[model samples]
Target: AQSVTQLDSQVPVFEEAPVELRCNYSSSVSVYLFWYVQYPNQGLQLLLKYLSGSTLVKGINGFEAEFNKSQTSFHLRKPSVHISDTAEYFCAVSPTARQLTFGSGTQLTVLP
Candidate 1:
């Protein structure tokens, strides 16, 4: 199965702090990358995707990631985080179907 795994179940950071959401994946042929964020009691929103080209990809809300083929991983990073950034981050892989195989889930808490 084309799947992705997020190592961190939860990440806690103070307001204006930096944070990272780690993600790894395993696929046979090819796959599409996606990062979704979910606020409290809300549906997931597409944060970013890495379809092709440059390994380093930038996303919304000052977030970015680098696709490392050798490491078989794609990790999200933010320089300075805000309280609004507090939410659940999910790493997904789209192999063939539109349905994305999501990670367990990660709760990012930004304290004020």
Candidate 2:
């Protein structure tokens, strides 16, 4: 069985504040981790991924996450967020399950 869990549904932070989005997963076998961001009505864009290398992986928009095998978690973090960072973030997993399964989602609201 494979599943993804995002602890928070919404995160409100002032502009230039740091933020962290939590994500956990369970799978019988190895899996590929991914974080995607969607702005308003725009399509989802790849934020980061954990394939088969270093635990710390960096992606676009100054976002990054570390894959913890023991904890089975991959949490996204950003040092300072801007108003443009306001959007929805989703954590996903891709095993041999045919397709990727996404988390409920985390809506990041950055206030000016």
Candidate 3:
């Protein structure tokens, strides 16, 4: 079984500020980790992924995440956020079950 948890339900950040969204997962076996972002009234888009190799993976829109196996965590970070970056972010994990388990999501509200 695999489960994902997003520590924060909502994050408020000022424009051009840095932000970090914490995510944690638990699985019995190896898994692929990912971060996705969804804009208002839109679908989800892949932000970053961690399948193997480097723990620090970069993604679109200046987003990045580090895969920490020991801590079972994959936290997403952005050096600078804009008002357009306001969206709902999700952390997902794919275990052997052939389905992706997603976190509750963290809503990012970038205030100008």
Which candidate number maximizes lDDT?
Answer: 3
Kindly list the per-residue Cα lDDT of model 3 for residues 1-112, writing each as its tens digit.
9899999999999999999999999999999999999999999999999999999999999999999999999999999999999999999999756899999999999999
lDDT tens readout by residue for model 2, 1-112 = 6899999999999999999999999999899999999999999999999998899999999999999999999999999999999999999999966789899999999999
Ranking by lDDT: 3, 2, 1
Evaluate model 1: give its lDDT: 0.89
* Clash statistics: count for each candidate: 0, 0, 0
Models sorted by TM-score, best on top: 3, 2, 1
Give the candidate number with the greatest TM-score: 3
TM-scores, one per candidate: 0.94, 0.96, 0.98
**All candidates' lDDT scores?**
0.89, 0.96, 0.96
Off by over 4 Å in 2: none
After superposition on all CA atoms, how large is the RMSD of candidate 1?
1.0
Which residue segments of model 3 deviate by more than 4 Å? none
For candidate 2, give the lDDT: 0.96
